[model samples]
Target: MVLFVVAKEETLQKPMYLLLCILAVTEIGGTTCIMPKALCIFWFGFKGITVDGCLTQMFFLYLFAVTHSAVLVIMAFDRYVAICDPLRYTTILSNARIAKLGLVGLIQAVLLILPLSLLLRKLPLCANPVILHTYCEHIAVVKISLGDTRVNRMYGLVITVVNIGLHLTLIGLSYGLIIRAVLRISSKKAHQKALNTCTAHICVMLMSYTPFLFTALTQRFGQDNAAHVHILLANLHLLVPPMLNPIIYGIKTKELREKTAKDKDKGSNDKAELLSHTYSDPAGA
Candidate 1:
């Protein structure tokens, strides 16, 4: 969070700071949205998962899931702007415009997730009372449904393909354009820097999103080990990005070093003033 705030300060001239704030908020929302459901899942077994409790968890979890995906999509767009449209990047992604788009994304995510919440609520929990994964994932919760789940399953599959697969494709396409644009630059230093920036974004995105598709795909075909792998991946999906994003972003941008230097200078001056005041006091002398 501090890194984000510092980035906001360093990139004050660009619209990148605003994007950073949006990404920071989405990350917080995405990672915490499932906490209530996860607490209940761990505290009481699936049998204890009441109808209302399950629905409530499902709602927020779904909201965060969609929001998380949308934030990632927005990040890709940010990259596109930085790489392909550098000339008008500030004007194109003005603070007001970025905020409006973010608001739209948040609303769309809520609208998308709400219907899933309602759909899942209508289904009855069957006699079998085990959720295979550590968290309250939609598939894990639905696997034990007494009523027909074909509709839910189909919808889930469609969403996964669209949200994960399609989004990834678009990100790839954006990078392709970015790469092409960078190559057109004759300056070797400039080209390498551009590539480096895109590389960091790609690495972070792969780490964040690949395990998700793996877990989702494995759940359909794999056996006992699949559940454990999915759980591990889910935890990784939660843990790794938040841990790495700031570091990767800081290094990629080169702004953290500048901010750190400024902070250290400020601290030294503050310390010098304190020492001067201490010695000036009669009691101290």
Candidate 2:
């Protein structure tokens, strides 16, 4: 619906909405990357993926995740400009620029994550490997690789920190600036409005990152934590945000909400008209 509405509604063809469309695409792709094989394991008899298959799946999984986070960081930048520098928001984040930023993010994800897959691909694996986790993660691949994995391990750690750390740092800075700007607004109504615009994004950012953070911390520090607990948290972080973002933005965004209402009304009218036509045509009835 986000993609559809953005494509159909000319009023929504702006930078923010375009980013939302990219996010929507990532959400769909991310879920698709993780769910099918998982469901197959649950429903059909459990089987395993081959080395190349795992690499491919790992590539897509990280690609979507890394890209999603990058886009969120970009969205934070959007919100910052809108709140902190409203006058120049249009000039700063032109549609073409946002598209380029999105492309850069995607290319960055590919460049950053492709090596991990390739690193794993080049390494030898056990004759019949089985990962403890439900999905094929990069670390899991490294864990199973039979060759010396010092480089893979170090590279993985560095990239994980760099990518996630950089994304978090930028998003935090953007929001901090946004808050300062909102606070500077004289009118209470304007302050509240600025804050309200940020509410959806704050919710989205928290939802997207909190579980993952908790899971990462638990895996790193919690010696007594259950394996299944980590697995569940990891999966939920991927699944829940994509499922909720559409609902969140739909309710919170004024233009999107108005568009949804209008679309609903239009649908109802069309249904009523079709019913009327069918009833009036006695032969058709």
Top candidate (lDDT): 2
Across residues 108-137, which tens digit of lDDT does each residue of candidate 1 receive? 777767777678788887666777765667
Which predicted model would earn the best TM-score?
Answer: 2
lDDT of 2 by residue, 1-285 (tens): 888888888999999889989999998998898789889888995767877888898899889988999999999999999988889999999999999999999999999998888888889888888786778866666778899999988887787789889999999899889888877879999989888988998898888888766766665567597878767877887789999999999999999989878888999999999999999999989
lDDT of 1: 0.72
Model 2 residue 98 CA deviation (Å) reads 1.0
Model 2 misplaced stretches (Cα beyond 4 Å):
220-224
Clashing pairs in 2: none
Q: Tell me, what's the RMSD of every candidate?
A: 3.4, 1.6
The CA lDDT of each predicted structure is: 0.72, 0.87
